[model samples]
Target: MVIYGVALLAFCMLVGIILGELLGRLIGIEANIGGIGIAMLLLIFLSNYLKKSFNLGEITERGIHFWSAIYIPIVVAMAAKQNVMGALDGGFIALLAGGIAVFLSFLLIPLLSKLGNK
Candidate 1:
């Protein structure tokens, strides 16, 4: 069952990559990887539903490990690029935005959880 689930996950990702490439070329939206993002979001919801409805085992931790492994090379390549130094010019802005996002999420999650419980 784990093997089957793994295969299915790989297939979904492959399809997402192919579709993303095709759509990016067609629309001239330079290098958009939105399909993979959409695929991941769908997978998250599907896995949650399956786990709650059918008692499938939680595989989120394993999935996170797998994705981290997959993204490491891409991250390394990006960091190696010539413009990497220039990219850090906006580091402070990026940090601020990220901090705000984290703050909002931290504030909202507990409130939302409490509201849901009520």
Candidate 2:
């Protein structure tokens, strides 16, 4: 059932949050870094495995798909809530990092387009 899929997502989210916290602590960051990313990746892999190996029904698939669709909006909202001022206060390094990331993402466009054509 779709409820089962929700439970599965929640479980993955919990584990991802724990793991993210641990990783942050290990790296001396003291923040929950990459938790949602980890959870989404986990959900992708495990849901595929369950669908292929266990023949999960359409309802569960739809439920998982719904959550996946909802995931990005939530992430965007959370990211928007982040302390951009604090990052700027850290120094020019943060701005540099952001610029580099934007440049790299723009660079990826042509590469991804070529790959898609292949």
Candidate 3:
């Protein structure tokens, strides 16, 4: 069932958040770092595992794909929220860092595109 796939994603998200929090604490921070990324990776691995080990129906696969499709936008929204909040508190250093990151990312586009062409 599609619901089953959603349940699996939810389970992975819960586990990922817990692990991320634990990792943050281990590093002496107080946030769920990389939780979304972890959840996405876990979803990928688990879905592949299930596909190989069990006969997941079309509906379930659809459900997983649905969430996967929206995952990026969700991550972007969350990150944007964090960045806005952080930038306000972080001031000049944060703005400078963001600008550098954007510049570097833009600079890498051509190189990355060339690599992809090969």
In the range 4-84, model 1's lDDT, one tens digit per residue, is 567657766777777778789898877756788766866678777877788655564465457657787888887787675
lDDT of 3 by residue, 86-114 (tens): 56788888889989999999999999989
TM-score, every prediction: 0.43, 0.60, 0.65
Residue range with the least summed lDDT across 10 consecutive positions in model 3? 79-88
Candidate that scores best on TM-score = 3
Model 1 scores a C-alpha lDDT of 0.72
Worst 10 residues of 2 by lDDT: 55-64
In what order do the candidates fall by TM-score, top score first? 3, 2, 1
lDDT ranking from best candidate downward: 2, 3, 1
Which of the numbered candidates is closest to the native, going by highest lDDT?
A: 2
User: What is the Cα root-mean-square deviation between model 3 and the actual structure?
Assistant: 4.5
Shift in Å, residue 43, candidate 2: 1.2
